[model samples]
Target: MEAFVQSKREDTAKEPSLFLLPEWMEADKRLTAGFTGRGGGVSAEPWTGLNIGLHVGDDEEAVILNRKRVTEALGWPFEAWTCTEQVHGSRVAQVTLAERGKGRERMDDTIAGCDALMTDVPGVLLTSFYADCVPLYFYAPEAGAVALAHAGWRGTVGGIAARTAEAMASAYGVRPDQILAAIGPSIGDCCYEVDGLVVTEVDRVMDELKLPEGERESCMQRKKNGKASLNLKELNRQIMIKAGILPSRIELTTWCTGCRTDLFYSYRVEGGKTGRMASWIGLQER
Candidate 1:
């Protein structure tokens, strides 16, 4: 069974064209977590899809309109929209009520160089833009806390997943076992081939993690061509497990951005200049 349920829109220009994690969101009525799809927006040309990222060259007004549409579709106020300047680093910033709407419209307003956003503030939606990088979601339901991490290869190797969980634990007194984790859509092993430097970093991270031989092999399938097919979502899942999130509690997405560019914006397949989807998690006010 796929974890991230696709909510398809008949019209490409419709709102809320996205994937929802029903396992987490439906189970907890107050929680909302999902990834945006490359449909139902007003961007043109290379970004003809629902480009939710403001940092990309997409028109600011168009991007904001798309974002506003998504919020309305979720029954959330656009003022609750919040985000960070994802630097593909391991830095996790704690968002408060005062920063609830930071970076909703412009780059200058975003929390600088932060790859992860975690918050216990109800109604504050924590969001991060992505183009094939793994999106890690954390929900300490027992503590009423949620987080979103942008795990590009650098953020992954830097251990952003563990850092976000640890931050949640420290800030909200959440036990690792009590956290519900989800891995969102990204480039899967089939289309994410890596060589040289990437392979070295992955090996180093696995060594530090002390993952079993089978697990290590599954994370990186080496080919005779001296390259490896990297399963980033799996690598991040293993990391979440090491961080104390239970295997059964974690929901992994089968949607591959690289293999399914029609549904997702793939930076690898799109020659780097492309739109970005948003992964968001927030606690609603009662």
Candidate 2:
């Protein structure tokens, strides 16, 4: 019951691979929401194929080309490929038509120090890069609003999920119950282990959520040595539910980027010199 499914590619394409949300597609033809994979790109060596992040040590030209490939495949104008400079904070920027395509090529052009981008404007694609961290998506079709958030450990504890819901409600009058959310591919619990302060922060968030004993243990498992394996996707899902999104309305993906590095770029597996995949959502203008 994974929500993010691999997209069938044309025989000729070599870069810009994608995984799409089929249910979202069926629910609204004008909506496009999904994540990118590691194949079909112009980067060389460590980045291999399709590294869409500009600040991740990949060649700027190569990264731009890879991003263009995704825009082309989605039939969205490259001029609308917008992004932000993610700093793993819970800051959400309200994207306007004027902000469209701000960071498509130059990193400095991106919305500064923002990890989440939300917009009600049609045709403005919202995107954020990720390797192992979680990608949280939000859509309020009633208000024609969509958001994409980058939630690393810092952002997770900072409550980016709840901040996104609040931003949607304040900016677009979107009710949390009316919002549909999707947690995209990231490092799964099996591949993600942390200790010390990381554990402390995660536990703090769990406490805020008041997770039941069984659920709390499922969210974090301790090793004999004191490190803990964390389920980031599940944590974010619970955070969204606490923010008012129904459990049934959130689509969680089981595709762990760390476990399936063949299909994704995992910073953990690649020793921190890896590429980044993108999560994108937009409402195409009719």
Across 45-91, the per-residue lDDT of candidate 1 in tens digits comes to 88986899888788999999999998988889999999999888999
In model 1, the Cα lDDT at residue 130 comes to 89
Residue-wise lDDT of candidate 2 within 1-286, one digit each (tens)? 8899888877425847899999998899999999999988999988989898888888899998899899999999999999999988999999998999999989889999889999988999999999999999999988989999999999999999999999999999989999999999999999999999999999999998999999888889989999999999899998999999999999999999888988999999889998999999999998
CA deviation > 4 Å runs, candidate 1 = 9-12
Best by lDDT: 2
Instruction: Evaluate model 1: give its TM-score.
Output: 0.97
Provide backbone clash counts, one per model: 0, 5
TM-score of each model, paired residue for residue: 0.97, 0.98
Name the TM-score of candidate 2: 0.98
What's the lDDT for residue 39 in model 2?
A: 89
The 10 consecutive residues of candidate 1 with the worst lDDT sum are 8-17
